[model samples]
Target: MSQFAGLAVELEESGVKHEMITYSGAPHAFTVFGSDRYREDADKKSWMAFTGFLEEKTGVKAM
Candidate 1:
């Protein structure tokens, strides 16, 4: 497994609550808009996940 995947597994085993989202075929910095490595699908999905998590925790929806 990749390093981050291993870390996620460890966190689960240790009872740490967290979310892990991975984008297949997304290069590094895929979330950076307008960059050469930007991936629209991955970027949008990741942004949604991030905002959703924040809303879930703080009960404030992102604009």
Candidate 2:
């Protein structure tokens, strides 16, 4: 299963309101704003921040 799918399942099981938002046909490396920008460092940072935010908000570790 995809990471997104697993995360959605976990969040649902935790009774947290969550949605998987995706832009169909968009490249994996693309930014959320669709800027065609790819930055490995920034992506890692963003992912960490997002995960931290989710944990803080939901009191659940996504992983």
Candidate 3:
């Protein structure tokens, strides 16, 4: 999580709005389709968070 933490700090210093999520026990590429580490809960959570972030940045609601 050090990498994520460093990025978060950089984003904070840059004053950019962002979101970071860390799913415990989730491997890299957990969201990749057909991967053994794919997690439904993580996918759903990340999707919603991403959509919300997009909506915030673009001022366009996701359908």
Candidate 4:
């Protein structure tokens, strides 16, 4: 996690656009279906974040 934070900081320092969204206590594969660790809220949140990121970079809203 520190590495990710460091990367985010580095990106900011280098003037690159970036965003980070962390789901606290979300286990691995939290977005995968049929997994015991799957979380509906986290899955939805992750997809929304991903779509938003894509839209923010590409200027096209996802359907």
Candidate 5:
């Protein structure tokens, strides 16, 4: 199994609520919008995922 799959298995065994995402070709710092390493697709997707998680868990909508 792939690394992410293995991690999913581990999380399942540990009974933890979790989510996993991978950016296929995104470089490091992909979330830093103005940085040279930024990747627009990954950044936007990740930000949306992050905000969704935050709102779900804390009930605070992202601005």
Candidate 6:
């Protein structure tokens, strides 16, 4: 999530338009387990933080 937050911040700082997508349910199911290796408690937190940062930075509601 921190990574994504950073990206969003970078994009905003650079004057670029960007959008972020977040998913519910088991992460593995959504990606066909593609994120198996990347899944972690910290990653989940990062994602949440990223979403929050995106909303605050872009003034866009997250779906």
Backbone clash count, each prediction separately: 0, 0, 0, 0, 0, 2
Question: How does candidate 3 fare on TM-score?
Answer: 0.68
In model 1, how large is the Cα lDDT of residue 6? 91
lDDT of 2 at 53: 88
What's the TM-score of each model vs. the native? 0.79, 0.43, 0.68, 0.69, 0.70, 0.40
lDDT tens digits, residue span 1-63, model 6: 688789989999999987766543335344233456454554666567778899998999776
lDDT of 3 by residue, 22-54 (tens): 978787877988889898788888888889989
Model 1 Cα shift for residue 11 (angstroms) = 1.1
Query: Model 1: which ten-residue window has the lowest total lDDT?
Result: 18-27
Better of 1 and 6 by lDDT: 1
Off by over 4 Å in 2: 1-36
**lDDT tens string, model 2, 7-63?**
998999999986566545445765555466665556666677789889999999978
TM-score of 4: 0.69
Task: List per-prediction Cα lDDT, in the order shown.
Answer: 0.88, 0.71, 0.87, 0.88, 0.87, 0.67
Tens-place lDDT per residue, model 4, 1-63, is 898799999999999976677898788789889988999998998999889989998999999
Q: Which of the predicted structures, 2 or 4, would earn the higher TM-score when compared with the native?
A: 4
TM-score ranking, high to low: 1, 5, 4, 3, 2, 6
Model 5 whole-model lDDT (C-alpha atoms): 0.87
lDDT of 5 by residue, 1-63 (tens): 387799999999999998778887897788786888989989888889999999998999999
- The lDDT, on a scale of 0 to 1, for candidate 1 is 0.88
